[model samples]
Target: MITNEYINRAIDYILNHIDEEITVEDISNYCCFSRYYFSRIFKMETGESIYEFIKRVRMERSAFRLKVEKDRSITDIGSAYGYSSSNYSSAFKKHHNMPPYKFRRSIVHKSMMNPVFRNTQTELLTWQECSEKITVEIFEDCTVIFERYKGSYGDLSVHWGAFLDKYKEYITEQTRILERSYDDPAITLPDKCLCDICIDAPAGCTLENICTIKGGRFAVYHFSGPVEHIYSAYQNLFSVWLPQSKYKIDDSYGFEIYKKTDCGSRHMDIDICIPVK
Candidate 1:
């Protein structure tokens, strides 16, 4: 993960205004570095040039919206990212290997609320169990230091351990460990997923990779089980409970606050929080 404050600021800007037009020159100037130098170091630390990273994030987030915001029209979704309908379809197909409509269709069919489906992949929660575990709650904004990791979600424990170890000095009784995921696993390929393992930062800490987590309304589910069982919780949460709820998921991004962790047992006590409107 990059500890460069300049790159961190640039990434924050990109995510905040992902719906708006962005250019390398704009980001370079915002970081107060020459465009060439900023681009070079960003690529060196992130493995993707500035434009490539922005494009990938836009594509992933748009694809995620396709899954969640089913009532929203494709044209409107594409337009939000400054893509014309035709261009969006072409680009989405090239990036995801299928047109946007098909991708949405597949998700609908795949996530049918089969009682048996919950038993298999999720291996933990029935509809009733999930219903009992979830609630709508408000969250306060927090500043956090995070390490962005890209790749398979199933293999993140080692990365988490290393990051926590590196920043061990900052840990405290009141601190919270959070994991903010930026892509839908069902849509984005496992190797291409992006996430951050983060912890609350103290005031005026001056950490290099720090950013504010803008908090608001959230559907927070309390879960305690083997980490493998989490798949079912999420499936049941979004596929079942969320659709029936009065609230709609907003674009603020969902995150997990780890209340307890036992990596050796592959177990966790975590609050799964998804932003809502």
Candidate 2:
């Protein structure tokens, strides 16, 4: 079996050298595994090919920087991630459906007009009043059976209901309801966002859409509020808390642990778990 430690090491190596040229052989050697074996195991564990993962990460990071580093030129941002101007524009447009210049302009325009975006910093300062509590905890690695959904975040409930109905047999007292969002709606178009609703399952559980959540240290922020406000909470987490905190974000995508959901009242209580180093 591929251990979490080995995967973590590989991920760490990737993040540290993301701008440099990385080869499958280099990663496989780092993990002390043969090329073919390492590639297969990595895909099995992470639900994506190594090259795809690297490309996606670089694109996402570039997207984030585009939003925050307003003064930086688009060409510089693209080059920083090892993409030339034309190639970067092509790759970014293909993934995000818009050019980098347009994406950055949209963020700036939205921030100016949207009250939620304008008040993110203030909201973060008073987050304790609206949130339950933030805590740091260690989580264990586990397997999950999930169903994927795409499109607007508002339509997730319909998908969740269907996923539960289809996989009710897997439900148990110990089963955790987890949601993994692969795209940032603020960066990527809402229609292109991808989410997965999942339930914890037994180890070695082979299902149609099974993935392993890499376990390690995480900063968990407990949030209790209307569903619409969740995005702001995340904005605060990334724009405010994370920048000020000593810990840096890890390679693993942060996920939400749903504790309670009441669609009738539009209330939710969830733990936003961000992987940290």
Which prediction has the highest lDDT against the true structure? 1
lDDT of 1 by residue, 192-268 (tens): 67788999998789867887788899998898988766666676676667766777888688899998888679789
lDDT of each: 0.81, 0.74
Q: Which ten residues in a row have the lowest lDDT in candidate 2?
A: 113-122
TM-score of each: 0.87, 0.65
lDDT, residue 71, candidate 1: 76
Residue 210 lDDT (model 2): 74
Q: Residue 50 lDDT in model 2? A: 79
Runs in model 1 lying further than 4 Å from the true structure? 108-120, 123-129
RMSD of each: 3.6, 7.6
Candidate 2: deviation at residue 207, Å?
1.9
